[model samples]
Target: MLRLISSIIFRLLFYRFPQLAYSQEEIEEYEKMYSKALTSKSEIKYSSNFPKLHFIQYIASTKKVVLHGSNHKGINEFEPRRQTLFNGKYEEAVFATRDGIWPIFYAVFDRNKLVGNFRNACISSDLKYNYYFFSLTRETILSNPWTSGMLYFLPEETFEKVNHSLVPFDEWISKSPVAPLTKIEVEPEDFYFINKVSYHNPKESVIVSWFLYKLRTKFFIKR
Candidate 1:
């Protein structure tokens, strides 16, 4: 058939003209970014310089996270992420599950430390961990040759970047149900981030985050 003839011709051409198949230039660009990330210092410094959407990763660890995401990727991706938050005197730690939550990556911010977390299992089952940041549009494990993770700016910056669409931080928080915004909605309307984060390919450990939600504030329905 014509398909068989085309296959034979294609193989013959590929073998005889190998240069036509490979682009060495593209590989060079990828390698440059790869080395730049490995050599960068502020990349791992306590203070970060990359933008909210720019990606970063740890040299010592396989984990990838957002540096400007107010110390967390999922939180910083919000339309208005917070910078300084007041923690309660009590040790406020608990499972911060959300409504209609899907299997995704979450970043936790605690005491200046940020960790990207994910879930592999459901909340109803034994509740095991998942490790993969999902690309909502691509529907695949989010990864890049230059950087493995991404970070979004804090809600304050978002407010500015989005043409002051958001109100003052104090006024915004006052309108919320709690003293501070805890659980954020990531629907298309609220935030149009192209990617949904978790983690990709986790090792033997609790990959999910216990500190993702704020430990300081709690909301009561008061029905």
Candidate 2:
């Protein structure tokens, strides 16, 4: 059983990280890069040199296709996460996140052009008993928005035990060592809102989703 479990875990890690396929000497180089990344500031380079920003925005543009009442996922999720949660928009769209690591985004579109996007992330629920965390979010723009901008978040605990796992906000806080880390605080599960916001209208949908890789906090986009 132990060998089987080990093999499965090893395969999963290898599948997620190409670096694991390298030799030990190469591993040391990766470690150096990781250490540098640890010290580097948290930022997404917006210049042409950084492909992530463009990719994320591109996804947002595509998301506007079915943004209206067609694939209306945000309509379904607003009840639970709202009235207690928060949201963020990429341009003009407003948004919020849901429980269970499920990512939801809303955007607005007009004449096949994206006008606004709302990107939201949620940190809700504490599964001390089940040992897992979950979240969901959706964004819709008043202009041209994707029919649905879908992103998924993994369990927060996965970041530590698995180096290849997506990093949660907790990881960044760990690196910076905030004063709140002294004691773990799990918010009440009574459908409390985590993060929510609404933005003004936009002339075009200038939002996109880059690679949903976890640097420290969960990141994603729909293109």
Candidate 3:
């Protein structure tokens, strides 16, 4: 009886708040504009010659698309799934990011290896650039069996902004399945800090002493 009452209440609210809903024609118009913005001359001319920080800033400013990265390839569509995020909360959604560099780490990572990893992205004090830090265990860094992955470009229409106070990256989540408009294959070498990655022990906290990090990197990391 309670479930039925709740359903009726929700239906009444939805109908009463009609302005909160988007019409199918409005949604289609938004998608068309997003697609056009993505293919604009400025977006087409973006190249590696520009600093990665600049690229991220430009994408965030445009808000035309969100990015998702994964080690698995040949993915035509992304379905909403339950995932545990850094905050220890489980959510059912398709996660994406406005920050361009954050997805690159996910693309190159191999979860099957089951090793420790730490990654974070932060904006500079002036808010003009983004800084990234990542570390992996000695064995994982040395073995490095995985070489490539895929970065997916998803339309921004259906995604909602995630308000995460603990994380610095601009994250978005969509409950509906998303089909990628395009995807790019990326290698470890393509990551900006691939050579500068530090070493850490899984048992310990993410923080590593400067001296210990240097010692481990010198002996174990292969660059």
Candidate 4:
């Protein structure tokens, strides 16, 4: 049949021209080149001069939080709305807050010191005895190479460099529930670099991650 003749001719041609058969190394090289070409098409290049950011982890205690009024000083009960208590335990509660809560005084950690900021602080969850400061964006984590197991605090410079159309920090604050702003004195020693092996991955926007995955899938695979 014609099919059999074509198959025989194809084999004979390949046998006559051994170069038609690629070696393992040659096939691997071709794949590498193809992947490089595909990646380069949409690859984002960050500046080498971009300053590296550090992650901040605060280790807290269960001791009652004490706040002082103008003339009165007393132990304050954790706000029920701001915290979540275990099934029956009242003393233990998680102090979790969203990315941008405006009019909120945040204790910023810059290397060795805990600085104060009215806004633009990267503070994350408020779980018992552990306060997280670095939050990763869906776009940055999935696309950017620098983002790793250790959540990189979205520094102002880095934030500006990347695309912000997904979830802008200001957008969150605009929709956030109004809360009274109060300055809290946080000790420098209270925070330290959280061990990545133990620290959990920083939460990212689910919607954003889904959207990016859908867009990048074409570049990643061909149907």
lDDT of 2 at 199: 34
**Which lDDT tens digits does candidate 2 get at residues 12-79?**
22112011133455445433432343356222222233222123323222221111111222222211
**Window of ten residues with lowest summed lDDT in model 4:** 54-63
Ranking by lDDT: 3, 2, 4, 1
C-alpha TM-score for every candidate: 0.19, 0.19, 0.64, 0.17
Compared with the true structure, what per-residue lDDT tens digits does model 4 show for residues 1-223? 6544544433322111011333465445444533453355422122222111110111001111211111111212223233212122232221323222111222322222222211121211112111212323223223321211111111121111111232211211111222222222222222232111011123534333333332333343211
List the global CA lDDT of all models. 0.23, 0.24, 0.59, 0.23
Going through the candidates in the order shown, the clash numbers are: 15, 53, 0, 0
Indicate the worst ten consecutive residues by lDDT in candidate 2: 176-185
- Candidate order, TM-score descending: 3, 2, 1, 4
Give the poorly placed runs of model 2, Cα more than 4 Å off. Answer: 1-98, 106-119, 123-140, 148-197, 201-223
Clashing pairs in 4: none
Error (Å) of candidate 1 at residue 93 is: 18
Best by TM-score: 3
- Model 1, stretches more than 4 Å misplaced? 1-23, 44-104, 107-223
TM-score of 3: 0.64
